[model samples]
Target: MRAELFDPRTEAVPAEWDKFLRDEGAPAAWDAGALAAVAWTSLRTVLLGVVADGGQAVALFCGDFGSPRRRNPVYSPVGGPGRPGVYFSRILMGFDEGFLFATHLDHAGRVAARRAFERALKARLGRRCLGVVYQNVSAAALPVMRTAARLCRPVSPNTVLVNRWQSMEEYFAGLPRDRRRRLRRTYADVDADSGLRVGAGVPAVDPVEAARLEQLTRLKHLSPGEVLVPLPSLYFERLNHRDGVRYFVHTDPATGALLSFDLSFEHAAGLVTTVTGSAAGAATGRGLYWDLYLREIEYAIERGVPRLEFGKGLVELKARFGCVTVPQYAVAAPL
Candidate 1:
């Protein structure tokens, strides 16, 4: 198989390409539609392509926006996943921005896929820079990456998710009764506070006020502190998109101070919870952690997203919400 490049808007990348990746357990972030949506931004690029025998389905090495040539500690930017064999120019920074399919080749294909990735990458943007992500990685892609002859920065800061469930309810029922009871209690405990009332959805948005964003930002780290990290203002501005992604916010009624914010994407498998933040809402006993994560479960039910995937592997707390593990993989090589 080999990799190729074409505009999704103008060219046909092949349905089989998608079918192959999806069949391999690729997540929502990997959808061609998602790739095109990302292309809506100015920085998107089309590098190279990876194709198998008879031009069947294969993976993509997609990317977008280059980091500033001059680095800023504040901007911890990464690349995007896109059409196979796509490449972003050196006009960007340290990030080797583009889609190189050889990344995260299925484990069975990793050894060969790694060779394909290196060849594909060499064809487009000759080895330069560093920093990239193997979106929705799988074990297949790992082997090639482990042996890639490139300057790759290993970043596993986020966790992977897996779903080994017949039913979401059954998954929940699987949790220890005491843990389930505690989760239930936390939901009630937070609501009991008189001065602050808790609610969900987009009905309440006060992003202009740093306190609200701050609450969520902190909860992202599961931390409670005045310790604030500056975030891309665009994150909040883009939050108002209202067209593609669905957001569920937990807010304080009286003061309108945001307690938490969760963002989920409607993927083929289910509604994948990509990013979540919390102020712990009201300083209740269990704090921002839900007693039973009932709200998350309720939100998933409301959306009818059958399998709810909490980002992979912060198991201790997220597992209580009945999220099973889903692991992703990545691969890379030098020019």
Candidate 2:
């Protein structure tokens, strides 16, 4: 098997690359078009594939390499050995979630493809390439991933709320009495605040305001030694027009101010909440965050989406909202 890299920005994404993802039932986030829409200035995105002599794709994955001088530091909790920027030189798989499409291959085939892909990756990046990191790897894919990397360390779990209720009322009815009472009260409080209104639709946000709010949220939650790369307004601007992408915004009706926003993606697998931003000094007692979560949950229920993925972090808090944790790991190999 020989490995090849494709830059969607420079050329058309080979049809076979998307075909493999579709055949494997990958999420919409992995679609070629979606990948191409990613506009982070600090990272270079590429699609990698391992093809056999017969021209059949044996392995496929999406990767992003961080800028050398502008390296982003790893989160303290999951930061591996060495300094904060140890992972800066590595290629990140699938941005936030890791996925390798190679179910069609046998064990030996998977190994060969992985080796070839790694070799090609190192060759492409040369001395600057320290390794490749597969983040948020699920348990089911661990075996296959093990064939490629030596380090498999547990990180935060991906939180998911599986939708079983038919309506918002049903969802509330299923919760425990105390939890249910709290949620009902919270919703009531939010509704009573005539000044606050929440809406969900295509992103119609001012990029400058959105970026400022996003950075504020990041600062509030940032860990020590963690350096986050600032996403330009262009990043949000580019994603605004993508299909299956939606933004839920909390606004002050009287003043017409955007207080907070959450970005979600609708995919065949489920609706995934990817990014969120809240205005500085936003009132926490108003339950704006919970309201956003409820909006997401209600959206999934209305659309008949099977699951609502909340991504990682806040394990206990998400659990209180009936979200189950799916353990995730980082598989890293140094060259």
Candidate 3:
């Protein structure tokens, strides 16, 4: 088996690309159409391809070799071990690294396919790129990366809430006593704050306002001395209307000022909170972050979805909301 590369933007996108992803139980973000739509806006060198055997495509992979500075750390021109940049495969929507081989492949086949894909990728751009970095890799994909990538390490751990409860109270009851009290107190405080108004769906914000919102979100999330890759205001506009996505915006009731926004993606099973941002000032009262988290749970219970995905970090707070933690990792190799 060998890896064959194709450009989804330039070549005829195969019908099987979507079908393969679906069959593998891939998330909505991994859908070829969605990735193709937004992939180009940030990445310059994109690699979309499949693992083929006897001319039949059996597995698929898509990635890019570029420094998405805003979303990632700064890098040097020649990237590698101790180098600046990286060859990355970022899964869109979900904001994870993108890497999916056919789940049906037996152990040996899976290993071979990974090796071939890496070999082919290296031949194409490995010489000039830093190294391959596959972010947020799932446990099932770990074995294949054993031989394909060199260093493997866990990054932030993910936390999720399986939406099996019938009511918001039932959901809250699952948390420990301390957590339950904390959430109730926080929720009550936010509810009593007259200046705050939290609502689901996109708020009425013009392009300039949207840009400011994105900037605020980036600044709030940035670490010390980190450079943020600026997401275009248009990206937010497009995401606000994307199918299966729900936007929860927090505002000041009196002045209609945008306080915070939560963007989550919906699927057959449940919803995953993808993007979030808030003004630093909102940190003081009404607990904008907790408010958004509570709103998500309330929304989930009302809708009766089976799960709510809260990506990595805020373990203690998310745990208080009854979100179970799931580990997330990155697999990389020195080119």
Among all candidates shown, the one with the greatest lDDT: 3
Deviation (Å) of 39 in candidate 2: 6.2
Task: Give lDDT tens digits, candidate 2, residues 1-335.
Answer: 78776665556666667676667665445556545555233344444443443677666756665432434532221212322222221122122544455566776776677677777766665555566777777787677666443788898888999999899899999988988998888777878888888787555677777777888888887766666656566556656666666788888899878898887777677888877888876747578888888888888889899998887878887877799988887887786
lDDT of 1: 0.47
Top TM-score model: 2
Q: Write down the TM-score for model 2.
A: 0.79
* Model 3 spans with C-alpha error above 4 angstroms: 1-28, 31-85, 92-97, 101-113, 189-195, 201-211, 252-257
Comparing 2 and 3 by lDDT, which wins?
A: 3
> What C-alpha lDDT, on a 0 to 100 scale, does residue 283 get in candidate 1?
35
Give the alpha-carbon lDDT of every model.
Answer: 0.47, 0.68, 0.68
Please give the range of 10 consecutive residues that has the lowest summed lDDT in model 3: 75-84
Q: Candidate 2 has which clashing residue pairs, if any?
A: none
Off by over 4 Å in 1: 1-127, 130-136, 140-173, 191-204, 209-229, 241-244, 280-286
Candidate 3, lDDT over the whole model: 0.68
- Report the C-alpha displacement of residue 312, candidate 1, in angstroms: 4.4
Candidate 2 — worst ten consecutive residues by lDDT sum?
A: 84-93
